[model samples]
Target: MIKIYSITVTTILLAVVSLISCSSEETSEKKQENLSTSPATANYAITPVDLRYVKLTDDFWLPVVKRVQEETIPYAIKKCEEEGRLHNFLIASGEMEGSVKGKMPFDDTDVYKIIEGASMTLISAPNPELEKELDRIITIIGKGQEDDGYLTTWRTINPKKPPAPWVNVVEGKRWESLTASHELYNAGHLYEAAYAHYKATGKTNFLNIAYKNADLIVKTFGDNEGQIAAVPGHQIIETGLIKLYALSGKEEYLKMARYFLDNRGRSEHHKLNDSYLSAAYSQDHLPVIEQDEVLGHAVRAMYMYAAMTDIAVLMKDADYENAVDKLWQNMVEKKIYLTGGLGARHEGEAFGDNYEL
Candidate 1:
């Protein structure tokens, strides 16, 4: 059953990788001449074969994949509904009247991640029912957005009262407490799920929501006059923007992604004294290129590394590539556990210092 579950999840990831590669190929060909200069024009070293072309005929794997499609996806969605993940969206949308209905500030991502998983499943196994359900979920999610494209439901429901007590928001406005609030992290997952939904069904319902929020991000956070010049306390938004740039050929998305990575660990860009914004807690101890060790929240480190790698390949950046290489070497040589788990400390869900495991 575990093997089946792993394969099921692997197929979902394959869908994301394959679809992104497809966009990369198209974008690369059109801007072939600009490959030398355009950050969005370059391609990754490897591209996965599209799920549609690859048949899962192996007796063991095929059953697992089918089980995921037949059982897991539906079960997961039901759990999300039971957990109030869906209700939070309705509350933010004003379709329901209640406080945010989750314990975590980033509970919106539970719905987004499930949609992404379901959408990825749709790529290999087309299901009209699942697609329609996703559309309904997407509509609820869309209705949660503020007039200016902001869509963090907890904050939208009540900025002063975050869903999680640790979120540290005292009459917070948007982006006020970026580190603990997870405002951008919510946006990142939204973009990812939207892209997957668009890829699977070619529908604009979710994609449009992603685009509108991204446009607002581009306008809100920057080095320009009146814009907030700060990076996300958590990562992944960088890669999310890159995905959008791949689809829209929008330079702003690509640049914004680069901006987030470039400003990490730069104290002058934004003060980082919060408990969650520690120099290493979120991997903000050093600028991304200067980061040699893989210390921090494991998930955030991985996401940041992904964006770094994307920039390294896309922009042909030697510094970024070197840093990524060093971080990789450090992880494999000293940090990684025997079980292949990346994080060792459960307290922070972080990597331990050199063999601390």
Candidate 2:
């Protein structure tokens, strides 16, 4: 069974404060002085302390992280194998003779997330066995990639037949249905996992896959002639690209991420999808900088907001910062649940109108 770690808000806040404090003896004092002068006008962003530097020893949170590292991680990996998540990779790579085996177009992300979680676990607790297993899994995943670096296994196995009926694939080609295809979403998770793996083991095996796929994405989408003008139906890719940019110092990756955000809600660039994939469903109803209220799938909205915050801090854009602030206030005051839960409407797994309970 999957074990959920129910971390309290106070515990999380304290952990964060402790981590920030550990950054430097004067970090907390400097932050306070900055807040006292101009609470929102800090010229620099806080640099996150690496997990290697911060050890979790408190009775409250250490157990939770241990549970994740010990029980949950192993359980998730076993479930993924049993559910054919691993086999899908081999099948796509032609190492196994079978069709895609999953219920979701984005099922590839299950493996990616597992790798990412395991990598994080390794950071705090070094395990040679786990590192070896990750290397094995990364190898299988790499085999599934197309020569050009596309790595969506289900699509690679059989683009004509999407794993789910809801995915609308008219052409049976890559990027045919950006809204439901989840191609970019898969890449996003892969990038995230790859980066984590790289950090944990100081390895480039998975990181190279991420970079190749990212390069393909950068070449595929843009305002340039012959390039497709579109945004992801779901979010997360923006943040993934931003992470890549931070690692590689690649301005193109950063530009690609900003382009995706800038083009959202601009109907002139591309028509939004219908039904659950509609503009509002993915927080594409308005440009990132102009979106004041939080709307859309709760997960999507949060990821978009995170990427927007990255943009605000990295680019020092006041407008983006303002929109994020406004949206946070709206969510806290009117949309968020009393228990801090989100997504009031289950049908779309989305946030409700203001004051909805």
Candidate 3:
């Protein structure tokens, strides 16, 4: 009887050990499965930048590009042709605040925005036949391109090159500022469109056009003599320039982008107390990171921060990434409304407060 009881105890111990070993093996397999699916674990499926860029380009940006291309840009051009104003660049319509004026006798800058927007359309919705139409549109936008590679309707129409004065100094005035002006804005958009075009269809023409545009920008502006210190009202140029750099594998473009980004934070223009204050207001204050909340000019802030994050993530800068992370977190988690509305009130075109969503 004692031997039988001992044998039973030994059998139970052996079975328990075997059961534990099996459980351990299963747990290891499960971990492997989990790692495979982990979004942040970085498999070949996608990266954060890719998703973010797509979200911005596909969902948010594509519609606006389509609307402007089909609706706004052509309408503006037709109006110009009808008014015999086709030679001059069309000032953007709707209420653009009293202070945000144009180069007048107009410039060709915005047509690229429309063109780039249209290019993005082809990217999001690839229609091979549509490429021909896009090519036509590009030609139209490029119609004003100068022999020296300069692309601006204002210069074509209003030759003083009537320096872009309002950039980076005022709230409502930034759009009129050079660097912060429409021309660079157009370049930025074109660069983005070029990137989308390449991503969507593996073509290089779109990227080439934008690259030439950047080269023109680099030649025209900078610390060089006769060049002003101001930048564009929008922030996309920095990222756009960076993209162009990567596209071409040229270091100059990256330097240009870095220069623009660094300039924004150095606190020079804002302290000038110059007429550009309105333009600076247009850019929504300096010290990009110190901006505790996402405030006025919803669209502008979104682009600026998004590009900033792209640069940060690509470069692996911890401080920049942390700031971007905080801002993005705030925008998505605390401030976004249920309808996908961002800013609660469009009055200032700014955000109200967190949780007000």
Query: What is the lDDT of every predicted structure here?
Result: 0.79, 0.79, 0.52
In candidate 3, position 47 carries an lDDT of 26
What TM-score goes with each of the models?
A: 0.87, 0.87, 0.62
Q: Write model 2 residue lDDT over 37-73, tens digit each, in one string.
A: 4212233344333333444556666567677777888
Let me know the TM-score candidate 1 reaches against the reference structure. Answer: 0.87
lDDT of 3: 0.52
Q: What lDDT score goes with residue 81 in model 2?
A: 91
C-alpha lDDT of residue 346 in model 1: 94
Compute the lDDT of residue 20 as modeled in candidate 2: 43
Q: Model 1: per-residue lDDT, tens digit, 126-154? A: 67888888888888888889889999988
